[model samples]
Target: MLIQSIIVGLIIAAAVVYGVVTLSRKRSAFSTKPGCGSDCGCNSGGKKLPS
Candidate 1:
């Protein structure tokens, strides 16, 4: 019984940790600055191209 409880607790903790990490990664991924990278479809160093 105690072992089962411990296992359950561990699973819950792992799930919580996974959730936190996933959310943090998503937040960081969306937190892009101007001209951050090519993924944002903008020029690097925040420079504007000739129109």
Candidate 2:
């Protein structure tokens, strides 16, 4: 039916919009920081470890 098709289309559009917003938020959060995020596991915080 036409109503069923319209509902499906709306659901798909909503899902796409939600994904875009989530990704943008994550990108902005990372960009606001200077170095890599804390969870990067790089252990390179500009400090030298003991030899």
**lDDT for each of the candidates?**
0.79, 0.75
Task: Tell me the tens digit of each residue's lDDT in model 2 across 1-51.
Answer: 999999999999999999999999999976635554444534566344455
Instruction: Give the number of the best model, judged by TM-score.
Output: 1
Per-residue accuracy of model 1 over 1-51 as CA lDDT, tens digit each: 999999999999999999999999999887876656535355566555565
| Backbone clash count, each prediction separately | 0, 0
Model 2: pairs clashing at backbone N, Cα or C within 3 Å: none
Off by over 4 Å in 1: 34-43, 48-51
Per-prediction TM-score? 0.69, 0.61
lDDT of 1 at 24: 97
Residue 25 CA displacement from its true place in model 1, Å: 0.3
Global CA lDDT of candidate 2, please?
A: 0.75
